[model samples]
Target: MDNLTHSLVGAVLGQAGLKRRTGLAMPALIIGANLPDIDAACFFWLEGAEHLGFRRGITHGPPALVLLPLVLAGLLWGWDRWQAKRGTRPKDRLPVHFGWLYALGFLGALSHPLLDWLNVYGIRFFEPFSSAWSYGDTLFIIDVWLWALLGLTLWASLRSEKKGGKWRRPAWIGIAVGLAYIGANWAISAGIKASSHSPYGLQADLIPSPPPLEFWKRDVIYRDPETGRWMMIDYSPGSAIPDAVPVAQGQPCAIPDLSALRKEDGELDAFLFWSRAPFATRAQGGGIVLHDARFYDPRARDRFSIALPDTPCEEPAGE
Candidate 1:
């Protein structure tokens, strides 16, 4: 999930009565919600697909989940103390409770992984302990419907707060609606996968990808077991599966030879780690071009693919 979603979720949690638990509780929640993304710093040093291997790893794992919130809680606690000593603390601010701050931080930080797990990009929940990727395939990374629900509820909650009306109900309702929406999408994804049948009667894998701004629609990717070919179909909830066609380069060409490719520098290692339904082909000039079936688009090859150099110019190897 995107940072905005995480922030809104944190704000929603705050509005649901957690904000009054302590001073700076809102900050603790909001900041901790996005804290796991600290791994994004890998972009500075990791180039190309290398960042994929590191982005949703250690920081999103159990150790970091425990430690990052502690760090955030300490910083927020220290800042609150410093403000008190300087007499710059707002008179209206609630009393600072270190325990509440830590609890909020923990709640916020825990929310990050839960939301991230609801997307197709997947996450390594057990990273450092285990590198296995888990996918919810429930919602798009950027869900407009979610934004609308959270945003409207947040607005209503804030308005109610100013009027001293019942505010917690709206936030609580928003959280419930969000969870229900996610559950509906998860069921939809499962249904689509179950209904999918391989064109050639070979074993196939079904991956349901959420389209931007369209919560009810999904793009399903089907991989051919024999040739590594990918077929795409647009799916709608409660509707029949549409005809699937070859995407990007059409039928799977040939599997490129990667036997000679070096893994010491972590290029292939990273690509393989990040790719869910990976396939290989020959580059225009030479070497191997690796891609994930989910992002296979004719118009956008460079966006989700990596090129490996120094391979023999031989025909693609048989599966």
Candidate 2:
């Protein structure tokens, strides 16, 4: 999920009455919610595609979840003290409680992975402990509906706070509605997967490709077991029987032996590590084009594909 969603989750949590636990509770919750994404700094050193493999890893795992809050709590504690020493501490602020600050931090930090897991981009939830990636396939990386729902409710919550009304009620409502919306999306994905039947040996993956506000629709990507050809379908879940998309429509692309190429190209190596269902196609000049079925689009040309120019196949390589 995007940082805005993460921040909103934290802010909403704070609005749900967690803000009264200690001084700076809201800041702790909001900052901690986005803390794990500190790994995003890898972009400074990691080139294209490499960040895909580096992101949503170690920082999102259990250890970081436990430790990041401590770091955040310490910083917030220090900031509070610094403010007091400078005679700048607000008189109306609640008493600072290190324990509550850490607790709020942990709660906010936990929300980050939960939301990240809900997206198709995937996350290494148990990283360092395990390099395996987990995909919820429940929501798009950025769901406009989710943003609108959460944003509007949060605004209402803040408005209630300003008017000295029941602010927490609005926040609680937002949380309930948000969770319900997420649950509905999850059920949609789960139901689609449960009802889907792949031909004997072929594997089919239903990836959520909700465009802006159209969350009912999704994309299905599959490779033919017999032909090794890759294809995609724009599917609407309500259809009891989707029209069989021709799997043997075209010749499968010859993919070179990736062992040596993966070792040579850092970006390709990372992309392979991150790609859930990767396939290849013939590129211009006898090179190979690599693609992940989850994000590939014919009209976008090579937008989600990587070109390996003049690369040799290892013996009987290619599909």
Return the top candidate by TM-score: 1
The C-alpha lDDT values of all candidates are 0.81, 0.80
Where's the lowest-lDDT run of ten residues in candidate 2?
A: 310-319
Measured by C-alpha RMSD in angstroms, how accurate is candidate 1?
2.4
> In candidate 2, which residue ranges exceed 4 Å CA deviation?
196-208, 240-252, 297-304, 312-319
Candidate 1 has a TM-score of: 0.92
Residue-level lDDT tens digits of model 2 in 1-319 = 9999999999999999999999999999999999999999998999777887899999999999999999999999999999999999999999999999999999999999999998778899898999998888888888888889889988999999999999999988988999999898888777666663633222455454454567887666555555555555666765653554633233236665588878888989898889887766555466666777777655544435677777642222324
Highest lDDT against the true fold, candidate: 1
Which pairs of residues collide in model 2? 255-318
